[model samples]
Target chain A: MSTVKITEEQLQLVEKLGLVFEGPGLQPAAARVAALLVVSDTLELTFDDIREILNLSKSATSNAINLLLNVHRIEYITKPGDRKRYFRSNLARWKNVMKEKFMDLEKTNSVLKEVVDQRTPATKEFNQSLEEMVSLMRFMNQQIPRLFKEWEKSKS
Target chain B: MSTVKITEEQLQLVEKLGLVFEGPGLQPAAARVAALLVVSDTLELTFDDIREILNLSKSATSNAINLLLNVHRIEYITKPGDRKRYFRSNLARWKNVMKEKFMDLEKTNSVLKEVVDQRTPATKEFNQSLEEMVSLMRFMNQQIPRLFKEWEKSKS
Candidate 1:
């Protein structure tokens, strides 16, 4: 296992970025989890290492890990000989993360579509605007996967 | 102004979608500000109205509004006779919002580049991964602007 000591400056920035873990709300526990993920690439820290360093309860750490996993921001792997799960940032393969985000955006557009569909005729103009927003979101979602595939091909 | 009452269920769903104002993470104040922008289209609301509805302090609300304005998510338009700054969401046009977000993503990729460049050779593999991440982000940034242009043309 690598012993990459995180500097104070890097730790501060990681915590600030953690504020973006879920969306706009900054939860300290979430931030701590995010910071660990950010440093994980270099540190190669196991779950035990992270728990000890952050002083987080096992369940709390598990929950944070789960959230990051849900977002495709981090991944867990087991070493060949070790049973302990090791977590690392998935930044190297961010295509999956972008794809997930675009899917969420598409879902939001669907919600807007429902709003537009349910509105009265008096607000037809507003409903048209919402429809346009949905179209824009959908268009982006369709294009992203293709773009990423092409990018990956080009890199290879 | 159309009085479209958002149901509690709808609000709860939006909150889960990271649309309604929660507080800062990946779903930044931008998503909430964007939500308010959409909601504003159906119901004319002042800055105070927005602040109250989102349960945000004046400064936080102002900062979010400023970001929305910068991103062209919301527009500042004055009434014919009123000097008060009236803000409205631009649901009909989202090309500008896509453009702004792409720009922000590019800026973040640049920062990531600096971090990767400054890292030690011992962590060279990790640094390479970071560079790949930066490349992917830059590609997305480049693709989005072109996609928006095509979208705008299609709409016209």
Candidate 2:
């Protein structure tokens, strides 16, 4: 329902960003839909509006939107007195996404821990390196949340 | 030549981890070689040794090792009186890799800034949200290096 017109170049940028998202595990269509929604003028668009603008089939749009919703990438908002649901990029959830990415360091740390536990090599330098990697991940794990808190404080 | 023999289970884990690395950007062969090098007992394996153990073809192993080296994922160490070069996980370079990943947030912020500038929307909430995303990225950009330094201090 947003009346603001999006330019062709902007649409191309969205298309390119769609691929970037795809690198992070999003399906092609879902990435495109998310990109389109993020760049939308109102940052919220109806299903029909998105489908038309993206030139996607109804099923594709529905599937893409649903995938995004499931992943908390996009969320739906219902307007009072309007039966249609409008979807927008869940910008708030981006912090969560970033937090999840930072958590990957923890995953790598755990994997390394398991490897070291199993190996138990006598090489002091190798063990030191492994422990250092684990410690760095732990430190990052501790710090990432604090960074989020700092951002929250600054926002206020 | 590392004297410690790698077990079958360890090799299987390396195979699994290769797929994980491939998800990020590395090709399959390169990811496998990287994982194999990471899990090596001495953390340093020569090209021929890696190819023989991983059962990779000469060109395949060479290409994979070269790719990993180019990306700073692995590094070579030359032993005195040995013509063969030993390759190992570049733990020191991982900080660089992490810094690069953190810098991606800046790229996203810049893209979002450009989009907002071009849009110039009247919606206060949308603009505010975009600015907030940019600010969070800026905050992270500043904090990531400090976190790295903290790790270095902890190491010393």
B1-156 per-residue lDDT for model 2 (tens digits)? 435468898898787767667766799899988888777665788888888888889999999999998998999999999998899988777767867877877777777777677664677787787787878888888988998898788777
Estimate the TM-score of every prediction. Answer: 0.66, 0.87
lDDT (10s digit) by residue, model 1, range B8-49: 654554455454223222245557656655543345566776
Candidate 2 is graded, for docking, as: acceptable
Best by DockQ: 2
Please give the TM-score that candidate 1 achieves against the real structure: 0.66
Which window of ten consecutive residues has the lowest lDDT sum in model 2 chain A?
A: A114-123
Q: Write the per-residue lDDT of candidate 1 for residues A70-135, one digit (tens) a residue.
A: 766677788898888878877655656656655666666676666565555676677677777778
TM-score of chain B of each: 0.53, 0.85
Alpha carbon deviation, residue A152, candidate 2 (Å): 1.3
Off by over 4 Å in 1: A1-4, A16-26, A40-42, A51-63, A69-72, A77-85, A91-93, A122-127, B1-95
Q: Which candidate leads the pack in TM-score?
A: 2
Q: Once all C-alphas are superposed, what RMSD does model 1 give against the true structure?
A: 5.7
